[model samples]
Target chain A: MTVARAVTCPSCGGSIEIRAAGYTVTLACRHCGSVLDVAHEDVRLITAYKRASANFAIELGSRGTLLDIEWEAIGALERRSPGAIWQEYLLFNPYAGYRWLVLADGEWQFGTLLLDRPEGSLSSVKWRGQTYTLDDSSEIETTIVLGEFYWRVARGDSVQCKTFARGSSYLSSEASGTEVTWTQLVPIDRRDVEGPFVVRQRYKPRPDLRAIREGYSTAPGMDENDLPMMFLVALGALFIIGILQNLLSGPSQCVSNRFDVVVGAADTTHKIGTIDVKRPWQFVTIKADTDKFDNRWVDLDYSLVDRRTQQSIDAYGIVEYYAGTDSDGPWTEGSHHGETLFARVPRGSYDVYVDAGSHGWPSDPRPDTLDPKNPWSAPSTVSVWLAACTGGYSWGMFWTFAVLLFGVPCLILWWRHQD
Target chain B: MSKRLILFSLWSLFLIAISGIATWYAWSPFADDERPTSSAFRGPTHK
Candidate 1:
């Protein structure tokens, strides 16, 4: 059971109610804003202030139910830091002792006295099983005090406070000379406390440590692992499907014809031969071979003209081979011959034309005394073979499209993860 | 339904749709073979 006692403020002679009765040690005159030390029988005036009282969202004497306990606001203290100010409302319950409701930057947090001493350094502390990081450490001074309090709190009383935070909970240690107190605070929603009290205004609370961590982890952005994993899965599936597609396709039937053409000494162009395509859909592969002793490259251009419609399609091929032995090992680059594939050709009678050109490094200087047998170092006789394969499926184009579809997201995820 | 269950279902549906689209594009019937192979005369040692 608790009883309220009425006392007169010595400075202003104004009536003041001490709700905590014997437990109350300080009272501020609501009429003159004077801090009074009520611990002794004769109330002593500690400080006098002329500043106007600031308005609060939760007024003194407001009753509210929090955490399944009934509490009444008995004292209000405004504390100031470097550039910020916050209010701490002392809430009392007959059976629950005292708790604190802190309002800072439109955010509310419920706090209770801590009995167990936490162990760790100033930067980090270990409590129970959780680790907390030091968030702030500073000296805070009380700028104003109103209503009643259990301690002799003056307007200019200062204390050294250190706060450590982990997720949504915070642990604060306050020291005055040799005495120290610890409090554990957890962020609370404003609606939870406003239910039983008449709140004039409500504001959104600032994000706690837990909320900030969740935002960083679960924000609406692509996950670094998810995109790459999806891409790999999609690529694997595509690779398997491509293999199956090729295996299921009809067997390729090829029709090959060879041609030998001799061009005039000065001319590089000549007519090869005529071909009769038998399938509706076929791939045409043209191969060229040239005889050369030293390193040399031969380029050939071929044109397929439709006999009846006079329509034509042009294609080209190249043959080059170079081999040398160095101290390291044997090295070879270009092949002696190369082939090209022209896909999806319609059946028609076609006339083929070939143009060949050769270029290479000049042969090593021949002995001046040796008689020259051949004037040209490159061979003139060119062997060409043309083959058409029907029922062939395309794997290059499909793989390109598949890689692009999956590779883009993978790259984006990689870039984000780097950041 | 619970929010978590609904979210899971939606995610599953999205993945299925993406995979389906990828499969369709990969196995397109109209695609032609344009890839080239090495010369028949060139041995694997040359590569």
Candidate 2:
């Protein structure tokens, strides 16, 4: 995390000052329209903003076509791009570790993944010398009833390669017919991810790792290990698709399921989180993106609670990482497009820190979903109908016809070898 | 046939199993008073 700058408000261009000691916040000037974010924890009063720096760095990377560069470091990325670079330093905490990032063209939009960890997170026995890098190119997802979600990098190319974890799970409500090809399910909260540990990619030195060239990989046909696996996948794909097709789109009714909500206390100024429901909906999920809001504000401030109860409810916001994966759709489009977080808690808290720079009731709970109109869509009804009537699976039949129908038959017709 | 046909075949097999169990409950011989019979159907003939 970069050292936060606590200076007089530049908008109204006046001297509005804030000096709270925990969790950084944004405070805006009622005059001149200037905005600033205060990193109360660092209190350095520095001039360099991390987001700007990241942008500049990313621009350099893109300009230089640094795809092969071991994606690491802020300044290094800045040097590679020929154009402008944008950088940002988001929230931080000792237990949840901290985040320092440099993105190419966010234009003032990013995500504040509202997940928390336990005490001594950096010093935990399992994290003394562990290494991790950003899982770039990984898909981020959000949806109407489902928001703030991500897919862990499973086997990158092979089917069933998505490392499905976190509570931002989903159920398919599409692709329910004989002509359909795919379906997805709601991810279950990985009860096993329950350590106060940070999630990072195993880091390697930029000079040592191979550069990224191919966007993805071509199927190596099906090796012995791969064929049996792919076959099982094909069949599981057929059956699981059948089952999920039933859950959200077919006939089964699932009762409201349960999930784990992890909320840890805060000590650093960069760590102010609360428990409160921002948007209340019935039988519908939600996701809130906090990126553009960060840019709209001019200043940040921090306020502490005397542990008082206001509004008769808990004076805090409980944020959940909405897991919206379209595993069952033609494509997991909106759900996996970006980072989203959902929290509908009451206002009862210990400390309330906010970047009050962007002020206003958040623009009418615009959640990230596939279709803005039909945001709460389930798995593909299209595929459900397909499986109910078709004999072999979609892909199963396609591949069988692909090789047997064409390849093998062609070889027989063209039998004579040149030799 | 398609994969759905195979699935239907498997489901039909399951249904057959279920019906077999249902028939056992309905037709297997039982202890005297428990059994439904022709005398019962006739409502007890006069002597």
Candidate 3:
């Protein structure tokens, strides 16, 4: 059983109990809040502070069972870095000696003092075959001190601390004057520590409002610039515009015809049909679909000849499909249906003509087994259906606008996650 | 809205307006303006 020694504060004459007795170096007067040096026989006054005792989440001198060991919160230090403030509770068990429970940003870390120092510099360190990389470095100042400590800790005590992290585990080194101390801290779930320590206030995860809107909660360096949100709105607007443009592009006039050609045949120009372009400028869509044929391809070059001017606007398309069994099993390449878009063709009466040809793979292929009239037999003659439509919407422009509208915000979000 | 968001919204609105006007005239910066030369049909083995 551990015995506590009661002493009188030299400054305030208030009774203060040293929980650790011989091991405790300093004790703060509970009555007048004065720091007293208890290492010597006579409890000497270090600093006379006449202030009200600060409230703690876990009251000092309270005994709690943690890690199956009964430990008492003997000392508490409130420290502040540049961006954050945290509370450190010094716990003591006569057999287990000393431990630190750090509460920062509503997260608890159970810290154990290192008996053997970690090897290497501040940037990286090796401990027990595990490598830890530098996470952060900051100068911490003790803002408030209470109860008893094993060291001569006073208010305004400062130390430069460097923390290296391996996953969720952290190795921290604090330097003050010529002395440096290392501590290994591992995250302890709030549920595990709160009940054991009799913590009053519970920790709740705060949600970022912007993150909920932007669909990412863990993105670092997120600010209220609203670039991402604006991009989303722009993308949404563009999508609506694309849908409207597609719906309201006006009634289309289309001309279509089918031509049967033999494999490895030269290009032959055929007059399909005529379509009238009544708009000032409109997109022209050229589409081709062919009956499925193995190891063969059909290529078509289209021309829209303006009957008034005798000038032509041209486009090209192909319908090719190949499938065969290889060493890696069945493989297929290319598509049987292809569409090519021509944008902003001027209004005119035009005769649609297509220069068509059919070729085989390996530059030479088997004779045409499919009859020109049959058209559905495989591995032979290919029947190509060519169609031209006026007043078609430019999906190319829509997609280009879509990428530009949405890509910037996505890139920024990606960069933030990378950081 | 924040000032930056308002400014960005205005800029996006301007872009949408431009796109609307351009689409009304069937004019697109990404349009294939080059006259059809060779076959645009790129086969699997076309160089």
Candidate 4:
């Protein structure tokens, strides 16, 4: 039953509907009160409703008055301040993974919204009640962030719904439970959890997590309990350290202005004369960067300009997950398997950068390949698939299945003892 | 003494003209720059 779209009303074209739960009062135009602009030019005025709840709203003015409320609205709570109470949320299961309600304890309905300054962080939501009906250009009050904790909803000693959050607002989820508690950082048996899921049918929440400012969050801190045996011992120690990181690394591909590492979830964002590498040297252009294909990045930066002595360098290309060669030639050291940058670097044609750093590097994107460089590399292990070229590359042919499974049994015992 | 100082100067000019019209009706129109509009809603994103 999701149908409510018809925005119009630039001034009085009059159409209005855009619901995610809003509208009950404060909109007079029996002919003209002119207070409209309900937003819907291209969206983004707060409208995330997968299941919906937190049912409550009261932003009336211009003579506010309307009553159907008989009495006791939750053991008597008729608050009169806190910006006058007019915000309550929850839009469908909120990503419905499961964590709907069980925070027991009666009459919830809390309030406190004040932030002229003082934004360390805060968000608390729970809403339900948007059948329809919202006029006068919508967008009454928008600001949302709700991870979880709401029990269905349907209270009315005369409609009274509002729940928790007053000082710095709260609700977060990075779950882990059993002991760790300081509001947990992770320990619920090493949580990386993603289950109890649900997507279109909506409702995907695993809740039981929090981080109001959490030292800015880099996001990772779990020991290991057995997430598929820690992903098969981290994918067999990254394929035996990617075979000595494929005989010494370099040239998975490099070029930077260091925009955090070329957007950071991994690396690789290239194009260096289409690279054929003949004596211009520094080749291996694109690989490494795989937050499961691509999960949005924030690093790697570069930008050169030898363009006949236009003379430029730009700087800050520190790529390292193991990152080795950025072109000083024949890549070596650590062989390059994950991240490496800012070493000698001087081939040419630059301007490759990434941002969102300081606390947002490749940090933890679940074995996504942040330090590497090819972005994904595998044209027969193209010489240590890059942190920026570590060197020693051999792939003129193709091998490494333990040399065709033990070199055909030692060549039939040396050709049956030399015939 | 002098017709009680002209009836205490007409009751101090009628209480200073009713305290200058209640301080010009509380600083004319609730200044805080007319305040009102505190939007807060965000659900459904990708644009």
Query: Best-fitting candidate, measured by TM-score?
Result: 3
| Candidate 1 local lDDT, residue A358 | 51
Model 4 DockQ class: incorrect
Instruction: Write the residue-wise lDDT of candidate 3 on A333-355 in tens digits.
Output: 88889887777778789998888
lDDT, candidate 1, A195-278, per-residue tens: 775555543455799986776576445343355455555566566545644543334555555554332222266666666666
Winner by lDDT: 3
Q: Could you give candidate 4's per-residue lDDT for residues A1-419 as a string of tens digits?
A: 44455543322223455553244222322222234434434322232221122322211111111121111111111222224433332222223221111111111222222222122212333322111111111112222222222331111112222222333233222112331111101111111111211111112233334542342232232121123332333344334434533433333443322121322233344323221122222323222332221222223243334454555434332212222234464332221223322222345544332222211222433445544667665221111222333132322211232243234324433443332
- lDDT, residue A252, candidate 4: 47
Candidate 1 segments whose C-alpha is farther than 4 A from its true place: A1-54, A202-419, B1-47
Please give the CA lDDT of all the candidate structures: 0.65, 0.25, 0.77, 0.27
- State the lDDT of candidate 2 residue by residue for A348-383, as single tens digits: 333333212221122212233256567676421100
Better of 3 and 4 by DockQ: 3
**Candidate closer to the true structure by DockQ (higher is better), 1 or 4:** 1
Candidate 2 vs candidate 4, TM-score winner: 4
Candidate 1 Cα deviation (angstroms), residue A216: 34
TM-score of each: 0.35, 0.16, 0.49, 0.17
Interface DockQ of each model:
0.06, 0.02, 0.30, 0.00
- Tell me the docking grade of candidate 3: acceptable
Kindly indicate the candidate among 2 and 3 with the higher DockQ.
Answer: 3
